[model samples]
Target: MLPAMGDNVVVSTMELEKLLSMKGGKGEASYVNNSQAQAMHAKSMLHLLKETLDRVEVEASREMPFVVVDLGCSCGINTINVVDVMIKHIMKRYEGLGLDPPEFSAFFSDLPSNDFNTLFQLLPPMPNYGVSMEECLAAKNHRSYFAAGVPGSFYRRLFPARSINVFHSAFSLHWLSQVPEAVTEKRSSAYNKGRVFIHGANEITAIAYKKQFQTDLAAFLRSRSVEMKRGGSMFLVCLGRTSLDPTDQGGAGLLFGTHFQDAWDDLVLQGLISSEKRDSFNIPVYAPSLQDFKEVVEGDGSFAIHKLEVFKGGSPLVVDQPDNASQVGKALANTCRSVSGVLVDAHIGEDLSHELFLRVEHRATCHGKDLLEQLQFYHIVASLSFVQS
Candidate 1:
């Protein structure tokens, strides 16, 4: 079973809509997807992740197969994609060395809700892509076990002791299931509503979020340490924020979150809801910085650093730009899916339909590079090996 990381953080569609409507629906899926440009960016991340794997020194033999575990594996598509790249690189390395290549065992893990349907509706019965990847998946000595290690969180124990050679996590790890205790109602720290967003945030609140990130990250490292061997490999790519301020405005990440707040504030001014209704609402998007990421991974005493880079995943794939109207509309409908049926019946009407079009128009022009620039994310890839005491 997957571990349940965040048992407390809960944000309903109505709350998100409050954020979405505040951001002119730019917070919706297509807009958010555009902001991340993840699918396109993933191609570049594939290379960085591969390099991380290559950095691991393999002990040549059949006695011990390389073990690679992907935390926050989510449906396995990204995990599979990464392995494919790592394999191609390793094959090149093995060819250069003029030695019979070694074998590997892969562990794909994720939260229960991830769509594993994409994983392997069916795995290749034989080594179709016979090279580096085959060794990683179907090990020669029968360690290859295609498994669905579904759990609520990655905080649980799953792998064998000193078994992992490479570990990778993508676009996750910054978020925990709950807000920190310091941010709750008990202390009444001063909170200010964002200029446009219905949700409120403050430095104290940001500090609380930071605390949770540190705590959760420490736990993640402790678990990974048990599984990874000395000189193990690690790579983590994720959505991280540049600043603690929720309304930091501009830059890829801040502009995206802040613009949504603006859209939400419009709704509040229109009297569609009261400030009290907004009080309890917190759209949790506390992205940790790359510094936080380095601090956590390096501080954990698990592995030595190989390389960490932050580049725009500006691969040519998404440069053509999607039909802004179509994608934005799709994203809006997706956001609506998060709302309760009762609320949909009561709150949505002609106004929702009217605002939806305005959003589509804005997203259309904000396409490609400019949109991606709005989110300054780090494509962090670090190689780690368990520290040999």
Candidate 2:
């Protein structure tokens, strides 16, 4: 019943502004994106592209640098990882054509707050050896640009006019907190605590929030329209939610409350607040349903979808651990245990959050489910290209 794609539901630029700083609830914390995760996914994507190139008759040469860009370049590790993919693919393609590879510049981009120092750390060696991060020494390229992205929303202006080639964003986007007003009327009423489906609630507010999503999505595509060159490819990957009900949302990000839920639960056990307080609060998560993703992408006239894939239901990490399930549970809990203080309101009271680790371990041990064993996280991958006007 919400606005379909192309409605151009006008929204205030200011409201979108608030989402810029919105934080996900404790369960939404990130730990999967280390150097390894980055490399694994990046390489996989590279292989897929290489296979595609083998079958296609294309016209790209190293003489004129082809562009490769990563949005939400968080600290730039993943961007570097993605660029690694491009270089390898280019080399592979060159070998096939018997041509020397061209020099390409990577546009590492993200929110203004991104830690450039971290990104710069990876680049003292400008021309990373043709293969891997490890193979190359640090080198800097003045051509490598670090710039502030669109200020208020991803839907706004982000890059120069028609300057992008292949655009890639991973584990980013989908950070917008669902329209806050949509899920709550009561000051404390929030997502997954009977917000979206409340029959007697303020439908106007909810509609307003939903409209915001449409607006943001349009803006996002519009930005891509401006930033990306015609016929360029884009790969978007992010977490998604199945339930639209405001009262129920569960996933890797929401479950890992790994630290926050623990602290709050202890406070509840101590009679500090109702167990339901967690309801008013959700990790600032707004993972859309599969339909939501499709509608937005196809609805936008700017791009045509090339492919959409969903990966869910597995412990991609823990499954390979040599130990049995219980041992794996212990290991997962133990490794994440130290994250308690940094992730939660640990300063509010001494280790109020540390208690969460114990409960996590206990649940993982007794209930016989590691985080992934529970099988809650869902990933969505959608590829799209600009539609010719």
Candidate 3:
């Protein structure tokens, strides 16, 4: 078991799998309703996806289906949209070749706690494919594929060898497999005493986070390399930093600013929670720069990079309209809550989690305009091809 911080919380790999998931369901705070930013980011990569499909080599066997899997596909409309777009692009590519598109099997993969029920419910009804679940869903207007859910950590092997043809993931890879244990040790120099994230932490803490990211990303690539066919393609979009410095405020730092720490500090000051409790909590997320990512992929040597670039994402809230600061803050807060609320709730109780985000919302409202101006939600977009041995 991995120590999650204080002595009270010990997390096994399986427990971490269960805890690290987006807020489920279609409620206001759920990931489904609050994933507009993720949707926009996924749409930004459609051109790259098309390019990847054009370059991918698909077998012309009707007996073997073309398998496409979306890793870290949380329950949301964005997940559905991404799969639909990929299928359309693949079909178009095959039609241009004057060949019938092969049957497709779409796999939606995530942690065990993901809202698979809601995700399946949101999928469009499928035509009779003679599959066991007649109600099984597929991409909208494209019944050529059958859909199935694969629930597990993508850090581990989730598929048979040489099975997948195309893989896509967006805004997901930055998540570390688990928080660096050293940072949680009070006696260690890497202890992140005052911050819930490494964005503005000290050098030792930052190094610990970077090392963990490298390890996790390498493991992820290694697993995918085994599962992907020789000519298979992978298009990944994850949060990234523009600068090599982990503490730079221009990149992902803008999104996870001092507001969270401030809120926690306030709670501690108010005697709602102990300082030790606040110090023990840290978010297991790191946004690597392009160089950082390249180092890992090149080190793995299982996939050749076709394209890798950094791009910024747009805000989820309405920025064009007037008097939208409150709206913007609310949107940003909801977005953060959707992604990290589970972690916060697990550390503190749900009631304190609610109180904490209330403070976060207020802070975001006060600084919404500044965030809009300075925020650069950089993403490292990579198109890779499996390197044949």
Candidate 4:
């Protein structure tokens, strides 16, 4: 069950560890949908990634082990692909300089509840759960690469000062540590009702979300600032909005929240959910405006915004099923449910999940499957270089 909401607390009350893990294995519960989308998003940023890596490689000491941190690296399927890209680029740069590449240590950090054992199983060894990084590396024809799982929230410190050389995060950081207090307050004018997220919210709801994002992002930058070395680079890709207003069609507006609202309203009509409960529960996710992100990073003063580009890419959730609306709806529903079911179940009840998503699929079909052909959400990719002084 979802925990009781807090009142007037400055600290986060959300159990981030419990809230964020991908479903273990390839079962229907698995976050393969999110991971696939994330991997594709990462692939789209390879050019920027390579550029940041090239810059990091120039200042890297050949003698010290090159460290790369993949923040919010959930089951390591997509994480491995991203790390592979970083390793490949580093190797090319070393070869160009007539020097052997430095030994690589890639740390996959996520919440403590993440399925690390399952992640480790996907390594070269067939079935060893207790194997060290050295054993895993030795088993495969490895390219001087080693892997370890560092379980922790990225919002807090995970490593010693100046420990990480390169930082990469995809499809993470939009999640707030907890729901903003103002929206949850009963007396406050910012109360957000009948929605899990603030996509089509009122002006007060938008301000509450933006304030929370600013605070959380400040903490994120500060933590990364401590971990990253001088002159190091960090690449971040997250869902963002082109328009400053939360209600604008350009940002997350209709693309995300409308579906949830549709399903919630359906449940309300069916008497499966109460209006009061619906009004109280809100999803702890935000798609910041591009300007919002730029100001936060620039204001932090720890990292220089090297490049910030907002692009729209294809969502992997929208599979090809033009002739079959049912199939298309199911595909989109399954993809979203894999990541959001737990939250929905927690807020409402486990029993309602099946019914809720059934309504969702029906709504999707009625809304036309063509809408799934292209995901109109924005992808804000930022390349940042840590300041020397």
Best by TM-score: 3
Cα lDDT of model 1 by residue, 249-344, tens digit? 123333324434444445557766444443333433346666766787777766566665455443211333344544433333333222211122
Point out the worst 10-residue segment of candidate 3 by lDDT. Answer: 131-140
Model 2's C-alpha root-mean-square deviation from the true structure amounts to 8.4
lDDT of 4 by residue, 1-389 (tens): 55533323222444645665655566654675445656676777789888888788454455777889898887757887788779767767776887755677889898886778777766542326665534544455443466788988888899999888899998788777778887867678888766657877788888888888888889999999999977689999887877768555343444446665688888788887677667767767788878889889989999888789887756545455666778767765676676667666666666777777777778776765565654466778889999987
lDDT string for model 3 (1-389, tens) is 21234433434466678889999888888998887767776777788888887778966766778889999999987888888778777877777787766777899999998889999888876666574322232333535567999999999899999999999999899988888888888888998887777878898888888898999999999999999988999999888877878766344565565677688888999998888888777778899888889999999999989899987776544344535778767766787788888888888878888999899889888987776666557788999999899
Greater-lDDT candidate between 1 and 4: 4
lDDT of 3: 0.81
What is each predicted model's overall lDDT from 0 to 1?
Answer: 0.49, 0.50, 0.81, 0.73
Better of 2 and 4 by TM-score: 4
**Could you tell me how far off, in angstroms, the CA of residue 175 lies in candidate 4 after the best superposition?**
1.0
Off by over 4 Å in 4: 1-14, 58-63, 125-143, 249-255
Clash list (residue pairs), candidate 4: 196-283
Greater TM-score among 3 and 4 belongs to 3
Model 3: runs farther than 4 Å from truth? 1-12, 129-142, 249-251, 316-322
Model 4 reaches what TM-score against the true structure?
A: 0.89
- What TM-score, computed on C-alpha atoms, does each candidate reach? 0.68, 0.66, 0.93, 0.89
Candidate 4 lDDT at 89 equals 79
RMSD value for candidate 3: 3.3
